[model samples]
Target: MFREVPVLPVVVPVAAAVFLILLWYLHSRDRLSAPRAAVALALCVYAAGVVANTVFPIFLDKPARSALWKVYLVPFANYEVGDAVTNILVFVPIGVLVPLLVAKAPWWRVVAVAAAFSLVIELTQLVTRNLLGGGHVADVNDLIFNTAGGALGFGLCSALSRVPAAAALIDRFRWR
Candidate 1:
């Protein structure tokens, strides 16, 4: 799965975001010196890159509609383990980063953020298909898998927040 996943989409944005965060911390008068904020911002930007790569036709260099709306709500229909897993994994960072960035937000807020972001991506694909003439299928399966990935990320972060050492580390990342 790791080998099959493209690294550039995640890496490029993350690197740029981190560099920007470091610069912001160094130059800005604001006290946003939390390492966690930097990480969260980088992750969110990386997640956006992943979504933009997956949904938009910007990479294709042509205006041609190659996608149909995939309305299937069922799982495992024409599913490859790699693609299904990748689809979920792509959004996992969003799941982890959003909750980390927002202080004291309830767990459900993670789900809401994940769902809203996923829906926006899907809707973008749907709209661009008609307007730009080239985009991904706005599939329900992608939304479900992406939301599941986000929930999983939230669970992992929540569990880590319970650990003494991890909590201490998380605190170091906190904006305040």
Candidate 2:
């Protein structure tokens, strides 16, 4: 049953956002944690959506289309390797920024989140290809590289957070 299931990468973070928001509402007493979690969830979803939109079709044999039926274009050859590179580049920021922005998140937690995000995306592609007769092939490289990118992002964010100017800028964005 799982093998034939259609997985949508965009849906993973979307669902996560919805779940986090519901949890936040239910636990309104913990204002700090709830808000942080909500922001983290939103960032995760946004990053995932961007990655999916940019990289998903690179793995497809055919071009993905817009709502108006216009075909999307990839400047480079649409191939497995290109898809892998794009996916990794797209999600690294998610892995990095989420942890830095959410103060209490540990390094390990950030890694875990990145890994989960990558796994969900790969699984989604696998299921989508299997059920839809699409040519999208799930690549293990994507899982590795995407997670690495996220970890890299986390490190960058962590390092940047220490700079007084960067810290001040981030402080301005915090919800009151």
Candidate 3:
């Protein structure tokens, strides 16, 4: 009964969007709300997935190690550290855009939204690994760091969203 989970983090959000769209199409009288929700949910999921994927491996007791050591090659590079750092750097955008993209998100509400997004990702990882025969172990650190990142991103977006220069820049970019 072990199902396989895809390695790519984006799959969860993409799948969610598809699922939401299908559900809305089948049951909803209002067509617009479904698509709107689908986009919002997908973005939230994507942001969470990015955070979870990046931060979880950092706190493992038996961290993912250098393959070179096993292969009898150079043993200096710690692969796990590299991977963790890369994950943090990679998810920086998720932290920023998810908040701004969210409609009418008040400053106080952003934290809750970020936390909710992080929770979904962590839970998904835990459930997927446990029920799907994957070796992944969910860690609490991932939840914390990911949520922090998302919160930071949200704050940055909120600050910039109000600035006239940033708005002008965005408009210029969108025009091109």
> Cα RMSDs of all predictions?
6.0, 9.4, 9.9
Model 1: residue 66 alpha-carbon error in angstroms: 12
The CA lDDT of each predicted structure is 0.69, 0.61, 0.50
Estimate TM-scores for all models.
0.71, 0.57, 0.50
After superposition, which runs of candidate 2 have C-alpha atoms over 4 Å from their true positions?
A: 1-84, 172-176
Better of 2 and 3 by lDDT: 2
Q: Candidate 1's residue-wise lDDT over 1-176, tens digit each?
A: 01223446655766677767655764474646658556756765676576558654533234545565434556667766786698788878766687656778677898888888888887877775554554466777788888888888888888898999998887776553
Ranked by lDDT, top first: 1, 2, 3
lDDT of 3: 0.50
Return the TM-score for candidate 1, rounded to 2 decimals.
0.71
The TM-score of candidate 2 is 0.57
User: Taking the tens digit of each residue's C-alpha lDDT, what string does model 2 give over 30-138?
Assistant: 5455445556566656765755553354333333432332222343334476766776677677765666456576778888888888777767666555544344555
Model 1 stretches astray by more than 4 angstroms: 1-30, 59-76
**Superposition error at 89 for model 2 (Å):** 1.7
lDDT of 3 at 10: 46
User: Where is the poorest 10-residue window by lDDT in model 3?
Assistant: 67-76
Assess the local accuracy of residue 123 in candidate 1 as a C-alpha lDDT between 0 and 100. Answer: 84
> Which candidate number maximizes TM-score?
1
